[model samples]
Target: MKIYHNQLTKTLAQGFIPVWLVFGDEPWQKDNSLSTIKAAAQQQGFSELIRFNTESGFDWQQLMDEYQSMSLFASQRIIEVEFSTTKVGDAGNKALVALAERLSEDIQHKHYANDVIFIFHGDKLDGPSANKKWFKLFSQIGCYLPLYDVELKSMSHWINQQCQTLNLNLAPELTQLLIELFEGNLLALAQELQKLSLLFNQSLITLEQAEQLVIKQAKFNPFQVVDSLLLGDCGKCIAMLDQLQQEGIAPAKIIWALHKEISQLYNMLNQLEQGESINQLYKQYRIWDKRKPLYQHALTHIKLPDVKQAMIRIADIDLLSKTSSEFNVFILLADLCITLYHGDKTQALSLKYG
Candidate 1:
């Protein structure tokens, strides 16, 4: 069965499955899900725990041997296999299929006879993973929980949910500030929430207090860069790019943000030129009231042709970043920033490619 992380608890309450496949890039979700499953299994008298970390030249026979081996004291057992990647070799594929057969036999014994639980976990899987014979067999008998990083649009809601758990009441502005500072790093957000819970003791956290106490987890996020670009703060934009590079934020992520915001501007600006109502376009794009002013400012300063040239430049940056390791992506990004800052007065194509 395919289940979400949020649904895991309810699913566990119904009954424990023969196996669980929790795979994702989100560390917190993967760790929490594993802990939840382990705790639940432990409560049900699956006291014996065995773990195997799969790597190069790992002996699959040992895993099978351990599963078949009877413990002297503990009646039930939980067998966990941690994978580095989803690419299990031919031997691993055969071993996992065989293990599934054993688990299926135990499932059929409705007497809950000789219960042996299996947990196979790894990082984010590709789409093709679902078709693998081992994955198919596991899904048929157990459950698969695939998790993704919380997106920027949903960060505020996620923070609110976390605050509720920590019993920390945040002022509205503090929530926004937290989103800006800790947008992509969930682990840092979790730690900060824990700190606030301890410090505030259920009191409301105002923006002032947050500013004074919260250590900036991220120096700046991509959204802030977009804001700087929109407002034509070329200096601030370049500085942010430098800090982001120093902080090891991926070039691809920064490029993605630039591309997204510029694409939106191009679309909106093109439509506005054709006599499309700005108000209607805002409604169509679901632009927030606060951001409407930014778009308006951008429309006054930026020409549609400039926006088209930017989209092409950003696409080139995206391709170079992916294909060439030696490509100086940040230099092009800085040039792009300057191009946007000057609007049509100084063209990017004339500056870099003309």
Candidate 2:
């Protein structure tokens, strides 16, 4: 039977099926689901693992050979096949259908049903591929799970679910902050959640604590720094800069980040002035829905001329960092943050040395 990705855990808790078909483009969900299946299989004493990857001109006969052969080492075994393409030709299709049929018969007759666990993994299956005879047989005898990408609107809900799984209680605002920070990247978000579980040890995490501990150590990407700056969180902006610097992140990376954000903001402001909707601009620029408010916040404090000037100054900084021997890129970055935070000004701000 077909199963939703979220339902896999509960389904596994109840029992293990003889065959499983897992396919998707979402790496984290796919990986997590596969891990869950493996864990459940291991608990049920499915110890022997036989793995195969279908490459160019792979012999389908090997799959048949392995399936028909009984293991001398273990009573139960997991047979995993990784498909390069879902279109396994006529011979492969027949082989898979036969295997599924045999497993189904074993289940009905109460013989050899507990001997082998068959798992198939590949890219997301299209409707035509999923509707194939072999796939239908597999689904009837087992579970077919397709991992879909989480949309921006539901990202917060997903994160909250993850936090609960990790036993990390987060305030609503903290959840929103995480949504803004991770955006469309679920793998990174999962890793961060793992780290949070270790650091907080199931303690309820407040917004201030999350900002201080979680965001700082979560590998504050350049985009996150820009978000802080745009939101006019001077403390966060400066703190992120320091964290990035101490982590040995290259100055060139920071410079490139500033240049990219300033350029995007400059273009976006000009388009907004031309009577375009924020939603349209977001689509045009490929901005995440969660970040719309931050962009809007930025536009309110930062004028067109300010972004224009910041872009020009960023170019100058880049040139100096590349060519000048005395150029201090970090100091320039700090100055730029101050400029971004306080808005554009005529006189150059005095650089304070730490």
TM-score of each: 0.71, 0.59
Tens-place lDDT digits, model 2, residues 35-93 = 89988998999999999988888887787788789898898999999999998888888
lDDT of model 2 at residue 351?
Answer: 36
Top TM-score prediction, candidate number: 1
Lowest lDDT sum, 10 consecutive residues, model 1, at: 345-354
Q: Model 2: how far is 294 from its true place, Å?
A: 22
Which candidate leads in lDDT?
A: 1
- Candidate 1: pairs in clash: none
Q: Against the true structure, candidate 2 has what lDDT?
A: 0.80
- Off by more than 4 A, model 1: 109-114, 219-243, 249-331, 337-354
- Tell me the TM-score of model 1: 0.71
